[model samples]
Target chain A: MSRAYNFCAGPATLPEQVLLQARDEMLDWRGTGMSVMEMSHRSDEFVEIAETAEQDVRDLAGISDDYAVLFMQGGASSQFATVPLNLLGNSASADYVNTGIWSEKAIAEARRYGDVNVVASSAGCGFTTVPDQTGWKTRADAAYLHYTPNETIGGLEFDFVPDSGKVPLVADMSSSMLSCPVDVSKFGLIYAGAQKNIGPSGLVVVIVRKDLLGKAHVKIPTMMNYQVMADNASMFNTPATYSWYLTGLVFKWLKDQGGVSAIGELNARKAKKLYHFIDTNPLYSNPIDPRFRSRMNVPFILADEALNSAFLKGADERQLLNLKGHRSVGGMRASIYNAMPEAGVDALIFYMAEFAKERG
Target chain B: MSRAYNFCAGPATLPEQVLLQARDEMLDWRGTGMSVMEMSHRSDEFVEIAETAEQDVRDLAGISDDYAVLFMQGGASSQFATVPLNLLGNSASADYVNTGIWSEKAIAEARRYGDVNVVASSAGCGFTTVPDQTGWKTRADAAYLHYTPNETIGGLEFDFVPDSGKVPLVADMSSSMLSCPVDVSKFGLIYAGAQKNIGPSGLVVVIVRKDLLGKAHVKIPTMMNYQVMADNASMFNTPATYSWYLTGLVFKWLKDQGGVSAIGELNARKAKKLYHFIDTNPLYSNPIDPRFRSRMNVPFILADEALNSAFLKGADERQLLNLKGHRSVGGMRASIYNAMPEAGVDALIFYMAEFAKERG
Candidate 1:
């Protein structure tokens, strides 16, 4: 089977091996006489699948006893509303760090629930850099400080985690989750939509410090209540089972590849190879601050705007697909996610150099 | 190529042909070089998939121009909250007819959003029959009247649609949708969890009248807002693409085997065959009132409850699995959904007779 290297921001590429395994097990799963999708969530067969998926996540993320990991639906967007509903408690305010489009969206949703304090913003800098943490104006009694670690749209990332002292810190790690090692204990909550580096689009993984549970406002629906979800193992309602199963397979594949540490090295190499080419080549330019350039999503503009279509068309001919940047950013983005092999990046770099030489 | 007859309640059986087609197109969907799961929701490929899926649903359900069909997540349970949130509007209350576990759950969730008047209830009769609509004490100005047409757990079904007049009728058809033909014009809204008769667990099909849009309370999250989902074509967030794709295939298969009108006849025949066997056999009994018996889920008890273990074991040995009744109602329930062939029911009847004879 010929598979092109996919570079879409999300609903993105998945490990080819996981797809093959899924296909092989599509009819019957381990003598259970049913596919994972066909198994009832309450069935012992599916209970094991859910449990193993959670266990793999815990192992990979090094989550401690203080954190509860939940596999939920409605994507990260759902979490935008859910986070505030669960965390705000009696407090009517929270701090938001605006790094890019995603954080802005999160802040917008949070405002409906409470008073949002824009602690620091990179918007004034064209969202190309992470604002200095010292510039944040956080309320001492705010519910929590929320930020997005990597913004898929702007290809901006935070090189370091922010400190919130006693106050809880919540991060939307949708685009950068599992791409590198993370200290699970540092944040009060961390949530990521699975489309980028986990497995599928429909499932969202949330890790919340245990003490934060059971504080959702009384008006919160059962499905949106973190405490209820944690109590029921995220099965308070029917979960996105097939997506969860695919996530489990991807987790297993990650472990077999020596966990996040090993994958992180390979990812660093891939990003460096591409970023280095763009930096030196006159034909290409990436505007994001060097410190905050996302390793997963690399957005670059061609020197001549007219050549943009030609670049994408030529790339498509060579079997490189979904390289167009997000419409908000309007350029080209090469999302070298975990599923993307280093060879894919090398091929892209080779093509870029050839294009530059021919154009010059 | 071996496949078991899956008897799961939700996340249940799918058309074998649909699964086969999904498997065939798993890697490269229609030369897009991407799995349906990998395609961008905005891409022309997925847009076509989404449009065709909606059109197929419209065709199968005979939906008129006045109705809008939405593909949503969170299952029927989410709709419990969303229904009232969207329709309750400026009204402080709505009327709910409680028939079984599902309707009770709906009422409980609706209570969180608004005052729910229990217009009628079958719990008084142990959920064996639907309450007479004539006796319903519905509010004079209820925003809407909600009921479950078929309760999968209780094995009770409403033989006739309730006349709500201008109050607008909403039905949870999760267990009975498309099992038969109905006048779509009678109800303001209808929603079905796809697992039972539609496709899979994660996708819910919501059919709402065009007039019901934009009435949601101000604080309702954008994802749960019916109007937002309708406007976005259910792509407000990443949907369950695989489940949606399978549902589209099922719609095509249904069209091939004649529309809902023809399928309804086959379903009625299947239910009659099983019910006749139970009514005549001395050892088998179904407690549901005959008029309210469900054609989709038939729950029967062995006269000698001790033989329950033996009955289930025998059925499993014959590859008739998941015949064990719901825990709340301890008896055998054979969910003969749309995908269960007549031969499967025949096999079930033959086994039931043999088991009864041996026990006697």
Candidate 2:
């Protein structure tokens, strides 16, 4: 019956209330006599659940009718190819900004389809900072400009949205969607794998500007076609029904917590507290530039790298689980996404301070 | 909580025991203090879960290590493209047998990736029967010969596996996988969307012979590339972890019910009972050829079409749910998946007979 503070990034922590609600309704949703997972995607009840989840995203983020909200499957990794396959239309090239591992992945996938212009990259700086937009080399005839708003593994984020002028701005916001509100009209497309700020690992929420719908490559896989997905309302296939239902519950839970604006403020405060502690503590160090540090994923290294395992073992004992950093990065990471409470942040800070005092 | 008999074709029905166990583990899975959905894919806990699920599928289906089992996403629709993109290799064409809607859809997606020579089709016969394999005009030079063992929509199932000689035989077992045992060594690949006979939607299990690995078209999306999935043990990206976990639970439940052989006997008996009643009853008829009718999905029509609504309403009243057939093939479809209990089938039969007596 006890729940720990789970800090795993992507398939990350979900609101406890949402889990309890899902648990309560897992056997039979309301009086429907079946679980939401058991309901057909085309059934009136499931359609309502699906539509309500989409509408909630729109309401929470102020998304207009001009954009098509698609509940897609295959996570953000699928969208890596989907973006180029759908957006690259007749254009021979697309513009990309490399922030970290996720952006690099997007670039690699896009290369399979068309020419990619790396307009900006933080690779030179060890993915510690977002390159200044002023020094960028954006393509004039690029199909779309793609960027990762929040790099989950690198603990890097864009402090300001890049203005692409008339060119459409496409963002992979897998780790940051709904942590704050963004002006939906500014982007041609926005996609997030639901595992982090949304729901589970399989479902992804894609918001594409209506005008950008049908420009898919001729050879685009039907399941990967944005236009087809929008036309069919994201039920191009059976959809990840249970994941979508859980996402709806999350959207409802987010609304109950005063929508994105309130949650954003809370997220900002949580990230700031953790970063401020890291900055002041003698035994902990975060390498990212303060201005571009991510509010969702916060990676830090102990003053002594040799003590990493003991530190993590201690964290696990305290039930502050999944503090181990990604294998690519050798330190510890605490991904305090929207579901991660400020209390969890305080607990993390408490553990960090205690670990520092003992190991310093 | 009262549970109804759900006859939904896919996302159809799940074993009650699986749901109960999932509910109990919703908050804290095996004292891990987080739900399986919250666990990182790379974590020891979730990896164990993922591995265990894959192992169970191999055990239940009697698959040898010669086949690389991939837990993938985007459902069977995605696989429609994935199959051709990965398997087509240097071949100019792939041979396909279209028996029903799902087969036709698969053929359609494969056409985008390569030339799909429909070796045979039952469309002229109104998709009521499987085209005899003896008369199939399969290509000798084809990369693979594909067929649907059971079509969820038209209730048509191949009575025997198509012999493609040296051409690797591929089957979409979406609705029939684990409903019976099949000789895994006979086919190059077998795939099934977890929703029907496995678990929830959004997860597709692919069993590809190891030789089929590394043959994906260069343009194939990384997520859709079977080789990449197998190489990474299906963790090329964060998979549909929750769905995979649920599928594992179903596999365990299947084992407890005495494996595929025992369930195959039950499934056959259930289908025979329903088909026999329809044959003898004055008010019911199934258009599909009885010899090739699906054991997984039983589609029947009332002798008087006017009584369809009344029949469904009464069935709903009796806690028999989702009996409505696919919109494309309107009548009634009671999908008796492995999870659909014998008692539920009996209840359905009793209801059908009573309705016929009252209205015929």
**Whose TM-score is greatest here?**
2
The DockQ values of the predictions, listed in order, are: 0.62, 0.79
- TM-score result, candidate 2: 0.99
Candidate 1: tens digits of C-alpha lDDT, residues B161-219: 99998899999999899889989999999999888888877788999999999999999
**Candidate 2, A1-360: lDDT as tens digits:** 378998999789999999999999999999988999998999999999999998999999999999999999988999999999998988999999998999999999999899999999989989999999999999789999999999999999998999999899999999999999889889999999999999989998999999998888898889989999999999878999999999999999999999999999999999999999999998888999999999999999988889988999999888999998999987999999999999999999998899888777
Best-performing candidate as measured by DockQ:
2
RMSD of each: 1.2, 1.0
Provide the global lDDT of candidate 1 against the true structure: 0.88
On residues B247-326, what C-alpha lDDT tens digit does candidate 2 reach at each position? 99999999999999999999999999999999999999999888899999999998889999999999889999999999
Candidate 1: segments with Cα more than 4 A from true spot: none
Candidate 2: how many backbone clashes? 0
